[model samples]
Target: MSDEELSSYLPHQGDRIRLRVHVRKEEETPRTKKNKLLTVLQEKLEAARKKKTTSKEEHNLEDMRNPHRPFGNRNAAKQNRMIEIGWIHKSNQRSTQIRKNKGGGTRKTEIPRHATKVEIIQQAIGLFFPNGLSSKGPLTNFNFDLWDFADREIDANVTVADMYERTKLPILRFYLATSQKTNDIGNTTDA
Candidate 1:
């Protein structure tokens, strides 16, 4: 087989795995709290406006004419204060790409370094088992509670099945072994 064909037949390389993780922007606060603070600020501004209008003769109308000036210094100051207090958080929509390095450490591309091995493993498991253990009867019997602990404890190179095997967890081992046998039998029958 040609190199291209051989490469296609082989399993995907580890470098190909890229996981996106949400990270809060620097100097930004939480969205909900920020919105709330903004609302309060708006109310205060309106109340001040009303008071100014009522006492227009006493104070100059120049400052009240444009509360938000062309440069918006007042608005900017409010935003800065909101960030300082964590009332408004950075946008989490922009995700950072996390790739696992050969040595097992993760490489985060872009800002907000945030992906961990456990998070990546959990994401991979979610992708692998989209419907969770509901569809797989044997898997339902297997202990899934160990996933988080296993992800942390096991070596990065080891496959989930291999990790389960290493644990000598009877339910998981039996399920996987039997499943393999069933697949083998099915293949033979098809042939």
Candidate 2:
């Protein structure tokens, strides 16, 4: 499949497909422990697919409306929070949406898909042999969780960098705190 088609299957199709999916080798994001965790999650989701409880989130017209608060009420009344639980097509428009609203920061390319009555895609790939990849058959079975693990690790690194930039911490302080023997900051999940 072309990159466009491949990119379209991000979360899974079939408004009912849980947040789970798999990988073989090529389609797999990367080789890492984080990806492994994601693959495990996808497998678990697949297992639960029989129950149909792991399905995606469906959207309603009311979800698009803005919340309105009545007089003397601190919290606004909303029909329902828009919880995107399904796959939506990706595009450049999504990234610049925040810019249109006059918000700061980088463009958020990835937006949660709005679940509605529509067709979805299902594809899988492995760290070695990604599903739907333009290649010969005989795709290998791999621990899909590696993809998740790698993604998480990448996010973690990105988070750390964002923290450093946002917190504006001094280089000396960061190294000193991170090098503590007893505290062993590298073992810490904290930034």
User: Each prediction's Cα lDDT score?
Assistant: 0.33, 0.27
Give the backbone clash total of model 2. 35
Clashes of each: 5, 35
Please provide, for model 1 over 1-191, each residue's C-alpha lDDT reduced to its tens digit, 9 standing for 90 to 100: 44455456544543222211122232254568888899899999999999988787544465577665444334322311110000000122331221222111222221111333343444433433446532333233322221223223333455433433355442221111112112434431110
Q: Give per-residue lDDT, candidate 1, residue 72.
A: 35
Q: What TM-score would each prediction reach against the true structure?
A: 0.16, 0.14
Can you tell me which runs of candidate 1 are displaced by over 4 Å?
1-113, 134-140, 143-191
Write model 2 residue lDDT over 55-153, tens digit each, in one string: 332223233453442434222122221211111111222311112122211211211122111111111121112342212223221111101111221
Q: In candidate 1, which residue pairs get closer than 3 Å at backbone N, Cα or C atoms, i.e. clash? A: 28-89, 29-88, 29-89, 30-89, 34-87
Question: Which candidate tops lDDT?
Answer: 1
Q: Give the TM-score of candidate 2.
A: 0.14
